[model samples]
Target chain A: MASPGPHSRFSARVGGTPASISEAAGQVMAIAEAHGYDKAARFAVRLAVEEALTNALRHGHKGLDPGTPVALDVEMLPDAMRIVVEDQGPGFDPAGVPDPTLDENLNRPCGRGLMLIRAYMTEVRHNQRGNRIEMTYQRPAP
Target chain B: MPSPESRLRVSQDAGVTLVEFVDRNILDEANIQQIGEEISGIIETRPQPRLLISFANVDHLSSAALGTLITINNKVRNKGGQLRLANIDPQIYDVFVITRLNKLFNIHADTSAAMSSFQ
Candidate 1:
């Protein structure tokens, strides 16, 4: 399928892991503001994007060469903003994640990222490539 | 990079207290706890217990950060006040919603609205 139109109406690109994650987030907020999203909605989008990017950077590219690239794509519509984060690394099983809220895992430092991603976005899915993930934010009713 | 430190600013009229985080990485769980302990200290002292976090300088956040916010919100609510959020960077906000926290806290567009929420 063809990509969404330039006016349909959002997009951005970033290279590398850490900086790419930050830039991806900045792009999402800029798009939200341009579309006049409410504060709560904007916050939700930002958090979801951050978690996805962090996963890409931390887990996806944990020990890869620093030269490896991570890419972020964002599209904003009238009612929602969709984000995609792709990385160059071996993908892992999303199903194997432990429950973050469990008492045994509560004090652990890193398990909650995926849990937070699932909680905030209206939809969260991983692509077959395993290194690519997509998330969406729906505009809350006024 | 600046070392992690916690700062608190009070806004009584808005019934919201703003906690600004200047940390190496808000994504770190230990940093989240340090920040949370400071905010909790403030809430423990306040008679009304209202809060609105302004994460203006915070660049990133992790699930621990989200949990810290939730814990603060519960503390404030138990005291008959509310915990809201403002000036959150998009990166951190995304985590908030992805974790379904947007549904739990009264996040505002700016400090003004978050403060006014208690009225």
Candidate 2:
């Protein structure tokens, strides 16, 4: 197939460790820079991805082996990026997550990861199992 | 004065403790935890700590880091201290805005403004 205008894809079974998360996020961001995504977009994608991976290992893989690896998929397009993160742990209801923006919850730490992932990504979808998430960010057409 | 293990550069100006990040990205678990512990240690050193955390060097931060900040804010408030964040990059500041943490924390444009508002 002919080049699709800086199209690129990366997939990995990333470890649950912090170093692994950083490495994976860095790779995704390097592609973002190479594809000419602006700082804001890179920040958004990085934050969302980090939150997703951390949540996967911390919450999804809870009580399981700490060495469990989560699935990460990144597709960098000319004007957008799509990312998916899936963990082996049982998934929970995204609706059940309390709103961190609420007055009562504002002072409380934790629970902002999913909220952020939603806010930054153009679109977010969770698999029926809830263990898998697919997020997309589409840049405005110039 | 920052310890070798610290992710923050800590100092005092007047009565306020000015804290800056040594790392460009505060997005990971270990880094955020260490930063939290270091700031919390500062908070514990004084009865009424006036802390100004500047994000001049932080290029990215995750929600976990935000959680750590909240924890620090709680500790500061519990001890009658104050916490102010300054010099946040516009992109990173949007993370605060998106999560509505701007309402939860006292944020300022720069260190000078944050330090002045300490009292």
Candidate 3:
């Protein structure tokens, strides 16, 4: 099979609730499979999406309502699948996020989300505001 | 009694608290929090708990869940307890390796191996 084509693209505005995130993530995963994404690629996409949306609710909208909505867009190409998760909150600095791998932070229970995203995804970028994250998952050759 | 929504299936084997996940994807926030609390409660019940978490059923995991595991690890350490993780699928194992958590955790290839390492 070829890469994930444009015809397989979809977008959803999902809340932070478990049901909402599961449904949205399921849809993207199914589409990815239809486009011939392997288990590893599908796994990466799912983790990145969950972490991005969860970050929006937990960090970006900390004091805000948990039900506040965020945008999740998945676009597929022959070579890569791009996902964007944007939240409606004051953005922070991505560079300021301390390295989770540091010896001091190894026991820290949080902050590894962003690091995982950066590690798994072929590419990860945060907007100037830092509330929006765009990630690209490069599909491995068949 | 564990809550109806309990995400873990826990049992006792040779003085060890063996735990497994009920869900395939341990990625949800509320569920992760509940699992953390439940495991934490188990850790508190023993003077020095020996916890062995198996990932046989878990297919997807988020960093939040990793945090929960770390928190559990810390609690186990503070209580003079021990913790072991096993049966992680290849994909999920890669996640631990990338986050450098593999270095921080005592991981085994299977339940038997982890169980044996407890002493």
Candidate 4:
């Protein structure tokens, strides 16, 4: 992996396991901050990346070979940063996820990843594979 | 065997000190303060730029835990160190992200990566 510079960007390949996802998140955060992103922006990127990666591990690649790896591609733009998380597991319908805040599901222990991703990032979308999630955050305007 | 509550334990691991709570209820304010103090004390004594925390046994964390994490993160950074979380259950990880805390601290998948942070 290339070290993040003033305009640093890098990509890392990690296994699609819950354990690896968290490790990957830390690596990404370090790179972002090393590239000069402010604290708030760094936090946003980390949260989004973590959530997306978790989804890939738990949902995207749920029962497949534990050895399957997830690909994390990150790019730091001048005004925004983008991350793409791809998994080889069976894809699902993104729209099927329920709103966590809904009265019925409010007390449930799961189903909040999407909400968190939406809250922390400026943009979030699922790719055709349905197993790939793309999240983007634009630095707060000065 | 003993009662379920009796089976629950909270031990302090020196390598990556963690307070494991087995209950599912939300953490209250008082507990947060106590945990923060312990974490602070760890930082004061170790003087390491990074600390690894595990939430493996904690099933649910309250907003109080979130606040404690923020306080710890700030204090660690002020001292030129960092606090990293590890083994956070998927459910708890969701809470961190939803509350936007997953960003505030450096979180790792397990203790090894967090400990390796200083290298």
Candidate 5:
């Protein structure tokens, strides 16, 4: 399959280790910053990316070996940012996550990451396998 | 590179343990783990365990850090104490709001305000 577009694109295979996952987030933020994204915008993208990667490491690679790889692909468009995070692990249903905002679930920590990603990004889509997700954000007009 | 302990400054006032974090911009895994350990230390060592986390210098934090905060909060609650947060950047504050954690914790404008809440 051909790559996303003519715009700037970055791809990496991040190690499943905690430190490497964080490092990948840093690289994604740097790329967003270099593309003229402001602080808040960059932060939103960074948080979403980190959350997605963390989910992959925590859920996708749960019972597997420690060094499984998580794939990251970012495409910077003229007015948007697109990111894809793919993990090689057992896929699960994201919709099954409990509602963290509810009073009963308020104290639980399980669903906050996905909530934040959805709140920050313009669109969040998961593949049928649930091991991959694509998130996009439209840049604020200058 | 400043050690996570150095980057996270802890002080005490009026029975409240105040934690001040200095993250140039983001709180990655290392800082989150360090702060998590520090919070655990506070729970273990402090007699009453009242905590007020200050984010005056932090720009952003990952979800893992948020999980750490939730864990810390639960620990404090288990001890029949409280955990509050103060001086958070507006953008960072939005994260709390989006996650609905702003309602779960006692958040204030500054450290002094948060301190007064403990009384």
Candidate 6:
């Protein structure tokens, strides 16, 4: 087995069963806190992570069998934290998501996560298949 | 339905039911469900359910929590009642803004303001 590096590292495979997002978020938050993320930063990371996982579960895995795997990887670096959430289901187009902030869609609940993820994270990117999302949050300078 | 043991505090002011969520952070899915059920119960039992959910101490909420609030809001309106929110943290309020729930619910700066608006 390869030895783990000095930097903080976390990896988990969350089962696709119902209500797994909460558990995934909890674990991510714990890892963030362990690396000295402040309350606000932790909150942002937690929210973004939850939304990403939920999207994977709700949109990516639709019509698929339960127990599909949602892979999680977290790397705490000196300047930032990087997280990758990937699912085994079909991907989506990030740009095609409607703007929830528009007057017509203001009352609707859709697109909230997309907005939040963009707002909180320093950078957010999706794989070509759209089934995988990568989010990065820059650690606040002391 | 969420049981009384959920530790949700209830108070009345200006005929408005102010629900103080015990969990300072409404992130867990189970907690979100419990709060949703509690709000639903309030909507069903209150003759004129003008509710003001106080998030004074709550600093964090998940998207599922947002969905729960939407469901409760619909139930309150369908029951011929009203639902508002007050004392939400700025960060949490931003969630409402991003989700555009700010336009859907009557949000107040504080519980006092929310109560007065109901009068």
lDDT of 5 by residue, B8-83 (tens): 7887777778888866554566767777886788798766688899989888787777778888989988888888
Per-model TM-score on C-alpha atoms: 0.58, 0.94, 0.94, 0.56, 0.91, 0.86
User: What value does the lDDT take at residue A115 in candidate 6?
Assistant: 79
- Give the alpha-carbon lDDT of every model: 0.69, 0.88, 0.88, 0.67, 0.82, 0.80
Compared with the true structure, what per-residue lDDT tens digits does model 6 show for residues A1-142? 1122344887877776435666667777777777778888988898888888877877888888767878888888888999999989889999999886788866554467777899899999999998999999998788
Clashing pairs in 3: none
Candidate 1, residue B58: Cα displacement in angstroms equals 6.9
Of 2 and 6, which scores higher on TM-score?
2
Ten residues in sequence with the least summed lDDT for candidate 4 chain B: B1-10
lDDT score for residue B45 of model 6: 86
- Models, CA RMSD each: 8.3, 2.9, 3.0, 14.3, 3.4, 3.1
Worst 10-residue lDDT window, candidate 1 chain A: A1-10
Give the Å shift of residue B115 in candidate 1. 22
Question: lDDT (0-100) at residue B72 of candidate 4?
Answer: 73
Residue-wise C-alpha lDDT for candidate 5, range A67-130, written one tens digit per residue? 8888899988889999999999978898988878888887775678888889999999999989
TM-score ranking, best first: 2, 3, 5, 6, 1, 4
Off by over 4 Å in 1: A1-11, B1-20, B23-60, B64-119
Question: DockQ numbers for every candidate?
Answer: 0.18, 0.87, 0.85, 0.07, 0.64, 0.52
In model 6, residue pairs whose N, Cα or C atoms come closer than 3 Å (at least 3 residues apart or on different chains), thus clashing, are none
Model 5's C-alpha root-mean-square deviation from the true structure amounts to 3.4
lDDT of 4 by residue, A1-142 (tens): 4454555466877775544665677678777777677866765676677667767766787788877788888888887888888888778788888875655554344566677778778998887769888888888887
The top-ranked prediction according to DockQ is 2
C-alpha lDDT of residue A90 in model 2: 89
lDDT score of residue B17 within candidate 1: 59
Q: Could you tell me how far off, in angstroms, the CA of residue B79 lies in candidate 1 after the best superposition?
A: 29
The clash count of every prediction, one per candidate, is 20, 0, 0, 2, 0, 0
